[model samples]
Target: MQKHSSAIWTGSLKDGGGSLTSQSGVLSATPYTFATRFEGQNGTNPEELIGAAHAGCYAMFLSALMSGAGVVPDRIEATSTISLDPTTEGSPTVTAAHLDVTVKAPTDEAAIRDFAEKAKAGCPISKLLKAEVSLALKIA
Candidate 1:
């Protein structure tokens, strides 16, 4: 089996910071642009991580579902938004995840919807999250 890699940095509790670096021994600074990374104390935070995980997981799940259903999607684009709400203890937790998925395929509406629902449940990241996740799927 092959393993992927990422790096993080930290300091104190409130004054800490981190960055994820690509390091499969490939030695590159890709995915480290200011837009994709670099965060302040109150910027570029955990919700972004959750969104990334959700989008990736959902895309993979949809691909698998399409393949299993004898339909090959020409394109699958999924955007996931994660909302955070504060707990009673004043800590922020993910409250919800919303996925907008657009898929191009030659499948019927019912099959598309069934695959969308299955993908939502079968995504590993979706299973890991405690947040309420919803999806809007558009198939054409």
Candidate 2:
């Protein structure tokens, strides 16, 4: 399935502003600006959206792996921390995606960790990102 989102930007790079809209309308006309992206101003940024996608995909994939392994999980929460740092080319690049995952189930912790590691490496977003990805799994 192909998904899509578009952005409309105006003005120069530093002073320009844009609105991001998703095909699903979940991010209907979300505002973003240079200040919001680099200065931590009030608005959504691409990195935040990427982090959300990574977390959501990883969690869902892990849950599916659990179900496929006959270990239905009670809960699986994945939080992604994306690091955007300047590269040698003077452009901001995604350097890492760290996932702090918490799982609640009666299954073996080793099994959960195994599935979580798989999800961390096999998620579509994870595969798309060339940055370093790390997973920290906690069982509850």
- Measured by lDDT, the strongest candidate is 2
Off by over 4 Å in 2: 131-140
TM-score for all predictions? Answer: 0.68, 0.89
lDDT of 1 at 24: 58
Backbone clashes in model 2: 0
| Candidate 1 positional error at 43, Å | 6.2
Inter-residue clash pairs, candidate 2: none
lDDT per residue (tens digit) for residues 1-140 in model 1: 54445645556544554565444544332233232333333445457767987999999899998998799988889999987664436666667899999888898888888899999988988887954757687785
Q: Model 2 over residues 97-131: C-alpha lDDT tens digits?
A: 99999999878888888988888889989998965
Badly placed stretches (over 4 Å) of model 1 are 1-15, 22-43, 131-140
Quote model 2's TM-score. 0.89
Q: What shift in Å separates residue 131 of candidate 2 from its native position after superposition?
A: 10
Angstrom error at residue 53, model 1: 1.5
